[model samples]
Target chain A: MSELWFYILAGMTVAAATGVVMLPNPVHSALSLVATLFLVAIHYASLDAHLVAALQIIVYAGAIMVLFLFVIMLLNLQTDPDESPMNATAAIAAGAALAIAAVLGRVFYAFGTSGAGAELPEGFGTTKALARVLFREHTVAFELTSLLLLVAVVGAVVLAQRDKHDARVEPVEPVEPVETEGQG
Target chain B: MMEPLATPAHYLVLSAIIFCIGALGMVVRRNLIVMFMSVELMLNAANLAFIALANRLGNMDGQTIVFFVMTVAAAEAAIGLAVILALFRNKPTVQADEIGLLKW
Candidate 1:
């Protein structure tokens, strides 16, 4: 039963990831990315990393993707007809690399043993273990992350304001009407 | 106690495939938002590898690092989208080829 569920979640993750790349429209891509993140959270859950799974949902699917949606809506950006297609040379190269890598991966895995041991420590996925490490062992890094978020928020506000200023300035330039031959 | 059909290598290989797909998307797509989403996909793929290795090694540190990575990724998305929004306001387009003011 667990194996069946794992396969299902894995399929969802792969499908969403593909959608994110294949969708032509940016909004659709962002939406599919949200689905992918959610599926990743489920994968984490299936792996018994419950805390990471919960944070994955709350932080990524909840907050970050919402910011993406908000920006997309704010811009009201429509698909431009002038957009170029994906580069053929890059696509071929990437495809070949992926094929080779996949083959190598299969070869490596064929030699790996399924009997490799994995004994998770008690409270491995508990919030207590996470907080203990985060606050005690990684306190400096935790503080730094918060500082980084603060800088990002301020930078976003500054950037948005500058754009608004630019918008106002663009309209201030006087438009000169062109004289037609009939008028002359 | 239970039988394991797939090993850690299986998960690692799967993660690598996903990561390659994300890399391809990042390289081939011209739209800035799509590129950003592809980057996020790559990060998630890395997270998968981290968790798999952590589980195999019987440690929780990788999961803890995944937490930090997710936080940084969120912050990155915020800043990237904000910059994209600003750029769009000036150019009214998000195509990577056209955004070349800084080119020397």
Candidate 2:
């Protein structure tokens, strides 16, 4: 039953992710990304990481994607025309690289069978277990991640405000010239 | 019953296919936003693989890593969209080829 759920969620995730990339409209892509994130949350649930699953939905599907939608609306962007032709050389190169990487990944997985005998620690899926390690062993890295998020938020606000300044400044010059002409 | 639905190998293969599709999308799409979505797809594919491996190994570390990845991905989306907005302000378009100002 769990395995069945895994496959079902995986299918949903892949489909939504494909939509995210294939949809021409940014709004649609953002919506599909939300769906994808939801499916990923389901996948996490199947893995018994309920807290992570909840966080995935809350942080990604809820908060972050809402920000994406806000930006899309703020920009009032139009769909891009299909003007650029595909670069055949780059396509071929990328394909070759993917194939090489896939082969290498398979080889590496096959040879590095070191963790086969390892066992999951007790209470592995419990919030207590996660918090213990997070606060004790990985505390510094965890704090650093929060700092990174803070920087990202500040950076986004600054970038968005910069454009507002440009919008305010650009129209004023044209209006001033018209007023001077009218006075003359 | 029903052969346990499917095995880890099945999930692994599916993850690979999904990853490949993401790679194809990244290569083929000309829109910057679409490219960003494709990159997210690739990251999700990696996450799937990690989960499957974690399941097979019976560990929670993979789940922890996934948590960390989700945080980073959110941050990435914020920063990336800002950059996109900045680029659109300058170029007025998000098409990849139209963005050639820095090209020499």
Candidate 3:
């Protein structure tokens, strides 16, 4: 029952993932990416990784994607002319990508795609189980990740700040205004 | 409903498919934001492979690492967008091929 669904969901995910890349309009690509991320969350759930799956949806489909949309809005980006599918660069890139995929496929085939996966252990992928390992074994790394996030936030703010004098166009001079009767 | 049970390989192949799409996007796309989106796709593909391999080995380590990957991805996305924003302000363009001053 689940296996068939896996194919269906995976198909949707792949198609949408490709759409995210191929769509000319960034907004449309973003919509497609959200669909892909949602399907990926479902795939995680199917693997019995409920916690990771939830995080996948919350962080990816929810937060990060919203951030992406916000940035897109901030930029007010125009359509890229370089997205032509028939360009020589695109053709070359496609050929190169195909070669890379073929090599990866050969490697995966060498490993054999048959029934080698082990059974899930008791309570694996549960929050409690995952927390135990995360807090106990990987605590240092986890704390470091928090620090990295802080740095990223500060860096983003600093980088995005533009000096008052710096304008995309010439700054209009401040005008001395006549005092309004109420204010006067 | 009852065909041969899906194995790790099935998941692995799916991950590969996503990864390939990501690689194609990164390779061909000109917009910096879209390129970053491709990077996200690749990261998710990595996460999928990690989950499948962890299931295969019956290990918690791989899953734990996925948490770390997500954190890093969030941070990367924030910083990357900021950088892109700065670049756009400077040049009014986000085409990866156009920003070649840093290139050799």
Candidate 1 residue pairs that clash:
none
lDDT of 2 by residue, A22-127 (tens): 6777788889988887886666566556677788788877887787788778878667656232467556845774685577457545633434534556665567
Q: Which run of 10 residues does model 1 chain B get worst, by summed lDDT?
A: B1-10
Error of 1 at B15 (Å): 1.5
Question: What's candidate 3's i-RMS value?
Answer: 2.8
lDDT score, candidate 1, position B2: 29
**Predicted model with the maximum TM-score:** 3
Ranking by lDDT: 3, 1, 2
Worst 10 residues of 2 chain A by lDDT: A111-120
lDDT of 2 by residue, B1-104 (tens): 01223444555665675677677677777777777877877777777677666666767677678778888989898989899888887878777888998899
How accurate locally is residue A68 in candidate 3, as Cα lDDT from 0 to 100? 91
For model 1, how does the per-residue alpha-carbon lDDT over A77-101 read when each residue is reduced to its tens digit?
6775654445676668577757865
| Interface DockQ of each model | 0.45, 0.38, 0.51
Runs with alpha carbons beyond 4 Å of true place in candidate 1: A81-87, A90-94, A100-115, A163-184, B1-6
Name every residue pair that clashes in candidate 3: none
Candidate structures ordered by DockQ, highest first: 3, 1, 2
- State the lDDT of candidate 1 residue by residue for B51-94, as single tens digits: 77776777778888998898789778877987898789779877
Residues A1-184 of candidate 3: C-alpha lDDT, one tens digit per residue? 7678777887899899989988998888888999999988877777777799999999999989998999898889877665775678888887887777677756654553555656667898899889999999999998998899999999889888885466533535332233354476
